[model samples]
Target: MVERATSLACDPSASETGRLLTQAFQTIRDDLEVRQAFPEAALAEIEQAVADPELPERDETDVEFVTIDPPGSMDLDQAMHISRDGAGFRVRYAIADVPAFLHEGGALDAETRLRGQTIYCPDTRVPLHPPALSEEAASLLPDAVRPAYVWDIRLTADGERETAELYRAMVRSRRRYTYTEAQELIDGGDAEEALLLLKEVGELRIAREIDRGGASLPMPEQEVGVGTEEDGCDYTLSLRPLLPAEDWNAQISLLTGMVAARIMLDGGVGILRTMPEPTEGAVARFRREVEALGAQWPEGMPYGEFLRTLDRTDTRHLAIVNAATFLFRGAGYTAFDGELPPEDEQVQSAIAAPYAHVTAPLRRLVDRFGLAVCEALSAGREVPDWARAALPDLPDVMEETGRRAKAVDRACVTAVEAAVLRDRVGEDFEAVVVDGVDGDRVQVQLMDPPVSDVATGSARLGSAITVRVERADILAGEVDLRIVGRDEQ
Candidate 1:
């Protein structure tokens, strides 16, 4: 009878806990204003274009691009295929061509600008572009000939870039593969010819980048899942490693972003994403923490250089390295009107150079704006007045939108975690200390069914301990855990 009651407390439906979760989600959805009012004439034009039997002509014969994304994802934006060219590799990146369908100064454009970017909440999403366009017409789906802005990158065997070219084109994707499927193929040596070549090129590029002081942090991420008959909604914190192919693909985007930044810098009148390097005081504090945790980072080197070294070490110090990375300043958009940013703020360590995000136009508004600027500059014409006017406000808008998106995402994850743990009030679990903020509540990571929570602890950050789940409120989106024991010194 006790076991039955415990099980009922965490039921997917009918349980008080589940009902509270559902209600919380409903409240969030209601506040998002899902129904956006778009101009009718613009909608009619877009529908008419998609409905036409004959679309624009495209050549998709030389390259067979394929998309890799999460399962059940509808708004695919990128496709890639790689091949060997002499002693180097040719990487073809095809991004969805959203601008082709958009009429300048149209209703859809206004609506997208208002929304800024996609906001993903627990139960709903405030998409930047309407689903009819973003998910269906503009998505680069398998067997679909879609318009795209393609970048062709050529790299030597040692992963040094030899040449690059950018142009607009149409492409047909040969297949759609998930991350897991692609990983299996690459690991088992059974990947398709194109995918195999891509993986090899990616490996070389990653090695070279790391050698050139590029830092990659390996941090554990939390993923939420809707449970089945046995369990209610659960939160699983897992280690998601970057696959070779994924890194290879990311390099293409990063390369383009750097190129975009260079172009803007040379042109002397454009918007840029800039981030200042970490301060010496901040680096010293982080070093103290590292030493306290009995970790070794190279002495007498720049912070960025030290970070690169830490990232290449064993898994035990992974979280510490991540915490160190947090000390760096955030990246933001800045307008350069024939003058450079303040000398101290001109460099961005994230991209290894100042950059503007010109990829992922289907999902991001900034990328679309940047693409428009690139097009105008390439044509030897001045940027549109509206786009140029947007330069001043783009920074604040991007920052505000980014903050809101992060809040919504975190709130949803927290609500789900609370729902999952509501029934196990007194269960003990093993956890690692993630942070020791506020002195009273230290954040810890739990194992069995992974989750992160604040607990009372004597040890500081990076300490491992056992904790008991004390209380949880699904609607409030909170979980209370208490430290029961610590690892012996």
Candidate 2:
């Protein structure tokens, strides 16, 4: 059973937690210069386009495509259909056809490049495109015949790709499912034939991923939500488990990205999401830390395979995942034309393959350009002049927007963590010391509320202990604690 704190008051007449969290995040939004609305000219352009749509001439509405996303998400980007092809599988992944509506050098086009990608705050989103197009017209909503960039991928039964092609077409999604819903259907063996194929192909793809030295650390996620207390509304913090279907669904996107990268490389002109291989020094440091924590790492085992063997829910294992973030640095976009980027600049170490961002055109600026390039190449047509010109400038713009988006996410989480623990300043809570042991403080995860904060404590890495909340400043999103005693496992 998941650990729980029985003493937390569930009823709130004032809703103190919720109110504080909202106010704190709102402060973050204002401080960050997050664009709240599009300019009038941009809005007018989007409105006019929505009123009279220009859909792709080719139709693919006959295929029974279905979309899987978070519950209540309207900004749907990708829809999929999978089927058995004799001894292999044929997958059709439909991406939002944003370029169809985006005119080169138009108001919407310039504005999207400036924004780069969607910035998601818990309460509101700074959208890349106006919602009229991104969430309504361009989104892959059910029953809607939407324009899409469809990737036709043929794969062997063992998840090896044989061929991939891209084209513009109109498609209609038949059903929409949330992650939880899809997982339930798969677990109960009540999923449709297409979804069953998704599981089959997904697992095979994962096995292939492992074989190629790819590593994915499935850590539990910490989320903040609004809940009611006797005082009124409060911030509800929870640690959510990663579901299997979610991973299966993600494999499809990764496959699409890898395929997109290959297409761009073959064409010798495109942008890629690249990361360098981790250095020996970083690996050596991690090995020492894991050994000190009593985690086993057999000699000759790749780090990725070793990580797959751990239970993600264990305290030490979770800490190891957090520490592994050290090796996942220096990710960036590399745009090239004609001559290919060097081999070191073309790899994404995590996937053990070349990769590009081409799946979510509705949310990301780069995907729109990537899709246009792939579409032109697949049709034996020259790449558009506008797209070619923008390739060199895309990397800097994407990097700026990425930093803003990440800042918002981190600030919101920290704010909520502060608000949730504000009233428990004197209380002692169970925690695991994640790191900072050689310094003046340690990073700890509280058991009940699943909050992570820094505490002044003398503790070994991965060891559990009791901590007393010393202070909490909700507005600043700061929480201070002190270690009390070592937890005997």
Candidate 3:
């Protein structure tokens, strides 16, 4: 670690900060050997696959389905429509039919398996499949009439599952609504029937989730991006607001995933995305932390329900959210051939259900295999040989890519933090102690710059404190802070 600033002048401007962060990002890319280009043979195969005819004997194209995603996303994996069916609701979710274009052991398949999933960086995206297919041909783009594996999921008025079925079909998206646009439409009362049903169903499903004791850390996401002003380029770090429509949209995916898990389990073979329930000790520790923060965790209230009461912008709540990370440990994929994994290992504790990742095949490699397995079982057919053979190996590949992706994300955030605070050494900033309450060093989140990094100190969990920057190492992506005093909350 570079202890003192020697290479750059004092009080580095935003341009200098941006340059340093960019350099650090590039170094991480090189160290990870992140693949950016597809092989010529893979590209050739993708071109041919893209030009191939769409699936025949398919229906559901006139269902007026629509897609909701982040702005500028091209690899649209899902499009959906919701409607009231008598006393129940019908959700038609169409996921991109990745296996339709993927041949077993082919070049495209080989490339996707190697990538495992889309590895996103601040500056670039390493997609699992070539853009020709993931973004254009096989993507669930609006009015494109793409082939898909459609889920007809029926739920009662209380959001209890009635029946779920999956079938191959061709579908057309009526429009692509970004999260903001969709939320605005819903809020303005101009939302169509489907959007209205989404809200109703989403709330109902959330109630069901709470009943199941599912816990989710709904922390607001912090993002760093490059911006240019008249003076020079600057790095802007901001938290993206979580919208209601985003949550509603995600519920639809979860519904589909849970349905897939049930089918696979019944059929006696499939891959499941699993997480062990948080242990009693971990939950108790979190409860103690919450109590120390002067927050109430109602007796007998589920942990997940209590977390939902937190406001992300509040420092104390932020600390609680940070502490909640312990409960989310041990997430992994389980591929079973003849028997389900142990019951304790089958449920994703967060969702409080057996769940599979069958929704986002375009960006994730495991989803392809899971989708294949679910489709076969849904059709009362045997799981394909290739799919079954790849099941046991998918967990390791997914874990590797998952860790790599997490490292890249963390590195980018750390780089931006170091850059933003590079010239602020010895300056006091308000922060909340999120971790290391009893340890020698604590982790803190700066209130002004909105950065989370390590600080050396002993502080109460969730207590607001003041810290002085000790060092900011841009190359190493570190911002070391020294606790100076407690900021009265």
Candidate 4:
């Protein structure tokens, strides 16, 4: 239930809590053996590759393209140019051409395969590619012409996708607007045609997503902060509300991925990002939990639509979002060479469509190969033998890397959670038991501070109660609480 955003701030020198968190994060990295730096061979290869990249013959730099991303992000992966195309729209989406710079099976390729994707930890970020490439050279930085996998998609007046094609090209981004900046422009009516069309197309795609039974988790993001006061240090986890521009931008990526999957399937080879639907039992449990959280789950409402109703600003609703993570189970990569996956297994149930990871090649290894495969297929050329051969092993590589990343995330968040609550040892909090009520231990969520953890006490699940904090260990990332009494009022 952890959603890590770009850190709001960090000050290890100012406070003990900050120092403890830094030490804990480093310990996890050391314990897990996560690569802190690229190997010399990989770095050397990246340097040589940057010096002489194989740029595309096609030039799309004349079309003014802009990127919308998180503030301070440098490893930009995508750029877009939207324009009117006869009663509908023309969307030109450009993805970073990692394949242009990377040699198959080289040292850099080996390094990125192991890292899998960039891990965004609070203390530090573990990048998939070296900063020289991911941040400076190969990144889709504004005003810098670079090779990219460009998707030219045509949409109907109803905002439905009509036709899509991909090709390699030399492109340049004119400006980079953060999500907030993009949203401000749209709201203030000062945005260009591309930015305005984004919102229009995004809402239509979202509607289509719901109509198609797509369920996406709107994970609440939190920013960790450490501040120095006159008396002591204060540590807090604050919710960072997501802007509408983020969702609009994501729709563009999703649209391209769906189109890429179609191409891969049509071409008779490639991999897919896949997931299975939640079981009936899981849905039932979620319904009961939603009711327990003081919300109504109207009968027959799809969980995805119900999720869209959640208010991210409300702490109670945020807990509902946290609890909904259970439905995001069984997500993984499925690779195929000749025969397509059985009709039933082909769909990514979460998106209610056939989807491929064709975006974000800068940060994800699979996307690099995916883009290469799609580009070759779109060009009516033979699929690269290296990419075809590597399909079988991709699923396993991604799973291993994803598992390790999740473990690191849980540890870091647990330590931060404990550290935040350590100061109030004897305080009583109004809490609701969310799980484990039948046993000696139960998981409780505080109403005020929005912390949830296992407490050694007996209570009915979902019942409001008063709890006293007994112990919290920052280094161990552990907390102890005992329920004193039930809250009747």
Per-prediction RMSD in angstroms? 5.1, 3.7, 4.6, 2.6
How far in Å is the alpha carbon of 441 misplaced in model 3?
A: 1.3
Counted clashes in each candidate structure? 0, 17, 0, 0
lDDT of 2 by residue, 39-125 (tens): 888888878877777788989999999999876678899999999888999999999988777787888888887788887765566
Model 1 weakest lDDT span, ten residues long? 1-10
Ranking by TM-score: 2, 3, 4, 1
Candidate 1 per-residue lDDT, tens place, 141-189, comes to: 9988888877677888787778765566778888999877887898899
Q: Where does candidate 4 have its weakest 10-residue lDDT segment?
A: 1-10
> TM-score for model 3?
0.94
lDDT of 3: 0.84
lDDT of 2: 0.85
Query: So what's the TM-score on candidate 2?
Result: 0.95
Worst 10 residues of 3 by lDDT: 1-10
Best by TM-score: 2
CA lDDT of each prediction against the hidden true structure: 0.69, 0.85, 0.84, 0.83
lDDT (tens digit, per residue) of candidate 3 on 140-174: 99888888999999999799999988889989999
Q: Which pairs in model 4 have colliding backbones?
A: none
| TM-score of every candidate | 0.87, 0.95, 0.94, 0.92
